[model samples]
Target: MKNNLLLGITGSIAASKTEKLYNSLKDQYNIKFVSTSEGLKYLDDNFKINNNIISSWDNETGSPHIELSRWADKFVIYPATANFISKLNNGISDDILSATALMYKDSIYIAPAMHEEMYINEVTQENILELSKKHIFCGPKYGKLDIGDEGLGRLLEPDELINIIEKTKEKIIVTSGPTFENIDLVRGITNSSSGKQGRAIAYELLSKGYDVIYIHSDLINPVPHARNITYSSSDDLYQSILKNIKDVKKIYMTSAVSDFIPEKFNKKMSRESGELFLKLSPNIDIIKTIKSQYKDIKVIGFSAQLDDNLNFEKINTKNCDYLVINNLKDNYFGSDNNKIFIIDRDKLIYESSVENKNIIAQHIVKNTTS
Candidate 1:
């Protein structure tokens, strides 16, 4: 049976974000909703009582708060209001949500949402500090608020909150974007990778609780939850990965590293000069290098083969646990949707139809993670 998640919705304008949150997590957990009276007002009639919603303290047999607390594996209060925060801090159990929160012994994840003044108020700050020592507090992020004023006290996005609630200590290293191999200060060779797929995978991993160390070229999009390290050249990215791989358990090699680099350095190249001659040398394989040293760590490699004829044998030589293959003919570079084939040493494991990168990311993580 799936674990039960008791989602507590409080009175805040950001309460509306819970619908998205529910939709995202419903498949992974058995979710039950419990909303405050004010929270109930914001939700439509679709939030039916007894079936999924638990609004009141009234129960036929015994205390609903106690029973619900016992049933829940984890409790999360999204858009936890200033009023509720104060009530929780003061140990006031006047309502069903507060009463249930008081009895819940496991970690209670809270995402605060309120006006800027109310969030920064001394009382709320103190209450937050008190709660932080025992429970997890996601965010009252800085952004536009419900009252047309923009500042701190905006509820965190649903994905951010989910990442916090589901977070684990395990480390994952994700490398993205194209690595440049400079022939001169002005000229270089690089691949066409835009790093969209890698960024999406990093976000998906973060949402599922992995602590991600993201290494990428400066051009790639950055995920909010990752510890991002920027690199320009293939050598720079290789060194960065080695520096941060001490405790990492998994490495996603999504960066399109240059296969060859200039054998000799040139200060500058003139276009007016006669045809330039240069010697090129093959670059070190980053994934193979890491896997050779850290055999226990799982390595997932990405191959962008221009030809439809994929050499699975060459991929197997890298010693990666999984290889994600994409053909250049499919126009994967910089595109939001992708068609991918995931294979192991023996055979292909999963083949995805052209779909959004986020969906592809979800499948990759689901297949890779135990």
Candidate 2:
């Protein structure tokens, strides 16, 4: 089914950019535009304006809010005012757009635009925290603002907004980042992973025409604009992998899946200079399990080593169909460029000395497809 996007525009000078966003998504999805009272003032008269283009919640007959809510696959509010956000948090419905948002049944995303000070206000922060709990607030990302000051509190780029809409599909599961096995609530075991490589790979795969389902471990920055399932421990990671493996055609085991996990965990634990004994146990081998059980599915494993100590031939012969061997001595985890040896069927079919992870991913996908 074609996606239906309900664009809610509120009072912000950036509301003028709605035309650009509308045009970008017009060919891709069924889009309905809604403008708030304050928003209507900012739009030029040359552009089409009508009640159809705007939404109202209190209309008794058809109940426009509920109708639109049922009509839309996703709801996106651009230039979401601080007031609108606060009302949303408190379930206040003074305006049609905000009312529709409060009543909408589908996934909701908002992009805030305001003054830097307002953006940083404690109340704004609290409302944003509440919005984040239930909705995706993309950015007041750093850029030239509507006001001359120019610090944060600017609307996100149009393409970014479109990407966010495109990425909300329920299919495609991508697992990224490093899983840390917690010894206690305060202390844990993690690896030298920035989650950049996995995130890049996941996004690259998505761009190459695959649905992405991301199981995030240590989501350092803006989590990749994709469906995400957060996991911390190797056990949780393994469970997520197994749950997704049946539906996923390819398993990119790019996460730094911990080899060992603390055998026990304490909820109320501290780090107050106490010698605590930790018993480590092997984590479930996700790739091998997927390779063995789901023989038809492709399993790709990451081999990260400090040096060239691992046997590539033997590793290749193992259950995983392919292994991307990366040497961490060169700081492969966080670096944008990496040297990877592609092991397939006990042979080095392709090798990259030093190249960006994106190019490497393209190469890997090409090889996998062929």
Number of the top candidate by TM-score? Answer: 1
Clashing pairs in 2: 172-212, 172-213, 173-213, 174-213, 174-214
Q: What is the C-alpha RMSD of each candidate to the true structure, in Å?
A: 10.1, 7.0
What are the runs in model 2 whose C-alpha is more than 4 Å off? 1-5, 10-17, 20-32, 37-45, 48-87, 109-170, 180-189, 199-213, 218-232, 260-284, 307-315, 318-327, 332-370
Against the hidden reference, what TM-scores do the models get?
0.63, 0.59
Off by over 4 Å in 1: 1-167, 264-266, 308-310
Backbone clash numbers for all candidates listed: 0, 5
Model 2 steric clash total: 5
Scored against the true structure, residue 312 in model 2 reaches a CA lDDT of 63
Task: Give each model's whole-structure lDDT.
Answer: 0.82, 0.72
1-370 in candidate 1: lDDT tens per residue?
8999999999887887888888888998998888898998777566444246777866435788898899999899997999998899889998899999999998798888899799878788778867766777666655688858875577878887877776565899999999988888787888789998887788676555577788989876554336778999999999999899888999999999888988645578777787978898888888888889999999999888876545578677898899988887885589878888888877888888987786788788877888
List, residue by residue over 1-370, the lDDT tens digit for candidate 2: 6788888989899988888888788787898877788888787776654325674544346677777778888788887898888888899877677778889865587888898788878788778765665687666654467647764577877887666656543244556778877777667888768876776666555443355667878445333334567788877887887776556777777788887878656575666857777798887677776677779777777788776544565455557777777888885578877877777765777777687665666576666554
Global local distance difference test of model 1: 0.82
